[model samples]
Target: MLRLCAASVRLRLGLGLHPSRVSWQRQLGTHGRKESREPLNSPKRAKEFIYRLQAGERSCLLQELQNFESIAIAQETVEPSPPTAAQIKYVLFHNTLPFIGFGFLDNAIMISAGTQIELSIGITLGISTMAAAALGNLVSDLAGLGLAGYVEALASRLGMQVPELTPKQVDMWQTRLSAHTGKAIGVVIGCILGMFPLFFISDDEDKKAKTDKAKPC
Candidate 1:
């Protein structure tokens, strides 16, 4: 009876060791299978990994930008010989053509109207004969004069050379006017000016040289 009771006591002690406790110890053990260790998802380690990845990306982006800048600089340096005198003249003529053409058109409209309108009628309306015609001419003249100054200032501010006004400013002005009026007023002015290119001649030697260069030699 005594031996049977001792065997029963040993069996109870073995069963008291839970299977769940054994599995937990095995899962968490670093070496020995006794104590269960806590989970090892440290906040510091996660933060460090994120920082390293961000730094790597930043470094790659900076290097790529620097390489692109170097390539652009090298390409610019390799090009030799500035544009010829003729090319420069063409550029200037193209640039200033719109403004000059607008001036001529404005004059023509005034002259044509003055020839037709009664002088006393203008005076009785409390407006000068010239002043009344000018109101009708404002849109065309303002676009040419005001827009030219604005474009020049914008180009200077942006650190870019203003292109020939014909190709650049005229196109830009026309685009702006078309957006506002859906009509190509700037384009019409450009065509008129282009038709009368001979009228743009200047007495200045430099101006003459540029004009001659722009002309077919």
Candidate 2:
């Protein structure tokens, strides 16, 4: 009988009730009393008691608290993020490289010598070779522009004020523009080459026919 009573008490405690029925009933009756005993202090009402030694309003303290809360809210609401290096490279390459390659290939044959070799090559070979050349030009252009942007970003992060350059200064180092010019020249050449046969031999092999026509038909 005593063991049974102990087990019941253990189960009640495990279930978060009082360990015995008498203790449980007492707790249930006293729940309201705990709420009524809470201190009756309101921060808004404290302003009415300003004449009291420790009850004066501290504007500086209130202002600091407001500033702290505003900062916390701003931090929570504004996400900290920036573009990755891969994204920047991707944007630069996709936006500028293809047109540059095509333009270069269009004009390639006019400038370079290896006409016989280029003629022996198929369109795929021609395109791939020209594309490679275009990519190289693009690399130089990007290197210049990228270096400038990188320096600017680094300076900004270091909290330094970088100086602005003049139009001449900016244009002098315009790598992308230089690259595009080369590409356009190449494409114009390539278009010419691709449009016409690589070489044209005159029909001078008909010299005997020409001589025979001079005699009698």
RMSD of every candidate to native, in Å, equals: 37.5, 34.3
Listed in order, each prediction's TM-score against the native is 0.27, 0.17
Q: Which consecutive 10 residues in model 1 have the weakest lDDT in total?
A: 12-21
For 1-217, candidate 1 gives per-residue lDDT tens digits of 3333322222111112112212211211211345433332577644442353334444543454475567656655453444444544444443343333333444554344442332334433545545755653443343333443343233234432323222223234343333223112333454454344334423374344444545764
Query: What are the per-residue Cα lDDT tens digits for candidate 2 across 1-217?
Result: 3333332322222222222222222222321334332221566434332222121123333443475567666656555343344433332333233333332333333223233322333222533435544453344333333332232223234432212222222223243344335334433453455334334422353344334444754
lDDT of 2 at 142: 35
Candidate 2 structure, TM-score to reference? 0.17
Q: In candidate 2, what residue range of length 10 has the lowest lDDT sum? A: 19-28
